[model samples]
Target: MDTFKKVTAIRGMNDVLPQASGRWERLEQHVRDWLRSYGYANLRTPVLEHTRLFTRGIGEVTDIVEKEMYTFTDALNGESLTLRPEFTAGTVRAAIEHNLLYDAPRRVYALGPVFRHERPQRGRYRQFHQVSVEALGFAGPDVDAEQILMLARLWKILGLKDIRLELNSLGAGEERAAHRAALIAYLEQHKDILDEDGLRRMYANPLRVLDTKNPALQEMAAGAPRLLDFLGEASRAHLDGVRARLDDAGIAYTINPRLVRGLDYYNLTVFEWVTDRLGAQGTVCGGGRYDGLIELVGGKPAPAVGFAIGMERLLDLWEQSKDEVVGQAVDVYVLHQGDAAARRALQLGEQLRDAGLDVIVHAGAASFKSQMKRADASRAAYAVILGDDELARGVASVKCLGDGSQQAVGFDALAGTLVDALSADGDAGMPEPSAAPPV
Candidate 1:
């Protein structure tokens, strides 16, 4: 047989090792609890879907469809599919296919991995995770304002600072079309200054060209027709409504007229929560009202608004905040010597566990000194030591790792005593396992 070769994770698709998992868990739980508080149920859709779902939803002319989709055809049936680049398109597809909105207007959330074919650097990844929140069948700006406030609350929970919000309105279809014509005319005049990317998107997606990072094109883009100036009465009122609600709640925001959603679907209100902390990729969350998407996806006309947060980037800020996302302190590490005592240690371990303590039964044979060293390494509050002599007397020695005090007690009373000591602060007896440390 040919020699087997070592395989590794594909580039930009990373493995979540033990050390990083604790932070992920903490962030995910916070999202779940926060979503539930707003009565948003969880919805899960497949990661792989028909390629049309995105091309039709995210806009064929956009960078996501034109340059960044991981598309493939099934070898068996020859159907085209692509790893979902974002959650909104797929969520709307599911809602329309299953008639999920028939019962009532729904607020739902989803958390999962999404893929894109792009250079992975710093916080950007080819395979990344997002926490997507969507509210369907409601057309007013009230929900839009609520979603923005909810994000402000999250910053408080994470102790995130130096974050700011940029708000804009894309207007209804007709107004956007007029502005599109005006913007194209302006871009054509400055075609000499436009770079390759800007020229490509000028007529195809004129709005994206406004946000380009090219220092040379910045002034030229700034002189282009402003979309906010083109907003009609209805579009202007909708944005004003959202602004009024945000002001009532005392949330500070800046109105960035150039903050346009390049996709065909987004309309009315769009917003982005940004921070200087993440360097070039500073948009931590972004979304807007996509009222026409449900209809495009084959459902009765339903209005929807939502946003997604990039987990990797947010976790980067979480680390910056110095929040302790690791598991709670270890309660006990059980150490025993001799085969007989090891056998008895198993039972004693269960008894301690039943009394509501975290007990890790030390395995294999090791010297007393080695066992004590491992126990201290565990960072546990106590070390329960069982030896051949202690087994013979039906007693065990417990050492308070915190104070280095040792006491001998009958095996029968050991569990209760440890439980009392650890539970003094009223923590659960059978507390959930904390993040596992590396072996």
Candidate 2:
């Protein structure tokens, strides 16, 4: 019998090692903290969905459906299934399937992997993570403004710098239809000037011509009529209101007319957060209003708006900037010595826990030297050591790892000592906790 070839993770897929888990946890924690403060509850959806959901929802003309979707037929039923290319489509699908629209105007968020079979590059992967926030069943420009503002708050929380928000109004149906007609006529005139993709995009999605990377086409696109000029009074007012609110909130932005987002469902208030620091594909976050999304996904028409930030891209930025993430709660690391000392250390750990401190104790398995090494790697400020001698004397060694200062105290006072050491500087070197070990 022929042996099957040894399997490996598909190209563009990579394992995140234990050393990098801390960074991922930091990234998610940063996002979740802001989301909680803003009152958005978490919502999770499966990784696979009916393939046609994306085709109808993501727009067949867009590159995602045109080329990049990871589609396959379900083995059991032969239904065409796909690994989601992006979040909004599946999010809307889930909302509709669950009858979430009845709860009209729910603020929901999700963080998970989205798969797209595209040529991968630095910061771009076949399987990537996204944090998306959706506000469903609200139809006002205020909803749009809130969405953008919340995204701004999230960026601030991430401590990302030099990130610029690019805002655009895709306008309501009639107004966008008018803009598309004008854009089509313009693109048709310069049809010969476009490359194959641009030319195809012209007929399929002429507005996308404005997003072309082709230098010549881009030059011609510069002089085309701006979509904002064709906006109906309502869209224009909505756009103005969003801008005004952003200004009042002290968030900076630029209005770019060409930013008709790549999805078909988006309508009005499209935006992207970009930075020059990330090469080429610099859009770290993008989202917009999708009023018809619920209806398109087979539910009642619910006006929804949201944004999704690429976690990989976000982590890239945070690593580069060395931004501070809040909620570093690991306050103490307890090091146990011999057999009985491990039991005493565990008791002390519980005492510290009862004092409302975050405590971690070394598993009794590791050697004392190994435990110290783990403590150092954990970046714990206070390493409480309980050896055989200290245990017999009814005392413990609380060593401040930073200054190498050791204090021997009664075992009963161990919790207070740890708390005092932690409370001294508050934020000084509150090292992030390590990721949970693999099972």
Candidate 3:
């Protein structure tokens, strides 16, 4: 028999370190709070779905399905299943399976990891995090405008100020059919100049050929048919209304005729948020209307609009602004000299916590100098010292670590003194311990 070696995580997977998770949690809290204020409820679907879901929902021509999908045969029943490449497909599957389409439009949001098999780069990964919103059974351009504006609000909540929005129109089914013909004809004229990927896109999805970022292909495709020219009267009016609403809300945007999202289901108005701070894959959020996807997935013909923000990409942007990401500050670290002192320290820790202060108790016994080093490393502003000498007098030394100033306080006054010392004014950069840190 051959011996087998233990295996670790496969390539393209990564463990989030403490500093990164702190930033992620801050971003998540901001997103959740904003979603709550906008009446978007949380929804969670399974990580794995029937393989056919992506095949039909994301479109088989897309790279996510043809190459990047992690599909397998289940051992239990031999059914084909795959880890989700995106959230929208699984959300739609759950909505149809659970009968969430009966009464009114469903406004739901989700945040979790999505899997894909691809070469990982600076901001791209095989296992990545995503935050998405799905608005089902809504058809008007007003709903489309609301979804776009909601996403902008989320970016504001993250304290991301330098961002740009790109908007486009894919028109309805019949209108798209006509546009597809004109687009293909243009690509055929430039067939010899096309690269391999561009050639594949031309046949697989002529619309995606317009979205290609290849400098040569982009130059060639510049004279191709623009979707804006082919938009039917309804789609034209709808897109105009969307832009008008955005302008009314003081949202800035650029109208790009070539902004067709990769997914096949999206139709009518489509938009993306980009930041020049991120190179290459600059789009942090992308979404559009999919009026016929519900019926394609076995639900009724329900119109919907949604978007997914690449959390990993957003965090990358946050890393560039870490100095602004407010980290947790330790209110106090109790330094005890002995067992009895440690007990008294624990008592004081509990008291401070009850009075709404963040307190981390010292573990085990160590020299006073060593304990001071630990307290300084914690970024804790205050250190409570209870030694044998101080315990004998029924008092503790309260030292402000920021300035090394020491004052003696009675045991009964420890909690109140600490709370008053760390109280945050509205303008203070320090965040309340109970609230999540900023990103």
Candidate 4:
């Protein structure tokens, strides 16, 4: 026999197996409902896009472009392509390509996997899902504040706690330019305190240096020039407007002058929802206004703001804070012995399904004891047992998995019986099966 090597999933890429997939499904449903409530429609873009999109849209100097992106040349066309490191760049590109803003400003959201070549750690993955929401073509601070308020509602919906919001402004091009000049000068003065990463990004992307996680540079970065100070009159008014709305909404937030997001496109109104529950990977979601990105991505200049929540991190926080349990796979499990009974069981399963109850018929040969064990393990509310005698009498023994009460339910009455039993249970603790009249 020839030996074969086992193939495994790539590092940092993970499978959402059945046991954990229930939680993912629940989280996704909550996200969909939340986005819908805010009038944000869904927009989907492909996982792969032209590499120039991110380079031009996200800024060539940002870490996503310089280091994390999974870039490759197409085998057939020889054109450079990349797996999207984030959704905003692709969202803007799609909007421009499709003339999404020709009519009016659009509020759109995307939920899907994003690829990045980063080391996997707690709550961070190479292939991770993001809930991205973008409000394109909207100006003024109201839309920005609206997005922030939307996030606050989501945290409440998810029952997540201990997560605080931090806000900052990057100002406009000239304002950031002034801040950049002053920041570079400050960094140059503290060159000895800067790490290799900080020194490399010092002049090319000086703002990122302040956002560094390096403890050695934290003190120096904190002391550097604040972007809020460099804000011009318009920028100041814009930040103040967002703050006013947030204050009115009673959403508490901090003005962290050093909260420059990792992306190069953000110019104003950057914020992050941070939590200590997930250790050093504390940021569960972050986004900011990227007013120049639409124009840079070959569209008419449109002001836009958006945010992306890391599903993994958010799910982690949700699990920590909520005591939710995954419900049973099926409402009823059907088991039968003998060929005629097996045939009847299949029909019964479909009939129960038609009546709007989830039903699974036991497959292949199995003893009653064996099938009952499987039914109990399935956590079904009731088990419909059909053997030769029960099938001959045109009735099934309905055993309540909860309290072991068994009743004879005729074939015509089985679906109605289970529905009533399930409705009475109401997804609270399962109650004992009520007595059924003689068939």
Q: Pick the candidate with the highest lDDT.
A: 4
| Candidate 3 per-residue lDDT over residues 155-256, each given as its tens digit | 766667678999998887787778888888889999998888779888779887777767877787778888788877888999999999999999999998
Tell me each candidate's TM-score. Answer: 0.89, 0.88, 0.89, 0.94
- lDDT (Cα, tens digit) per residue for candidate 2, span 1-439: 9999999989998898866877798778878888888778898888988899989998888888988999998889899999988888888888888888775578999899998888899879999998988888888878788878887777677576888999999888887778788888988898778889888888678778788887877779898888888888888888888888898889899888888775556787998889999898799888888887888878888789998888889988988877453334367789986789888878888888899987789985888789988887777777888888787777777777777777676766666666666776755542322222122
lDDT of 4: 0.88
Q: Each candidate's root-mean-square deviation in Å?
A: 5.0, 5.5, 5.2, 2.3
**lDDT of model 1, residue 335:** 92
For model 3, how big is the CA root-mean-square deviation?
A: 5.2
lDDT of 4 by residue, 337-430 (tens): 9999999999999999999998889999999999999898887888999999897777898888877777787777788878888888655443
Off by over 4 Å in 2: 1-8, 262-264, 323-330, 343-370, 426-439
What residue runs in model 3 are displaced by over 4 Å at the alpha carbon? 1-9, 262-264, 426-439
The order of the candidates by TM-score, greatest first, is 4, 1, 3, 2
Each model's lDDT: 0.88, 0.81, 0.84, 0.88
- Worst 10 contiguous positions by lDDT, candidate 4: 428-437
Top model by TM-score, which number? Answer: 4
**Candidate numbers sorted by lDDT from highest down:** 4, 1, 3, 2
For candidate 1, the per-residue lDDT at 68 reads 92
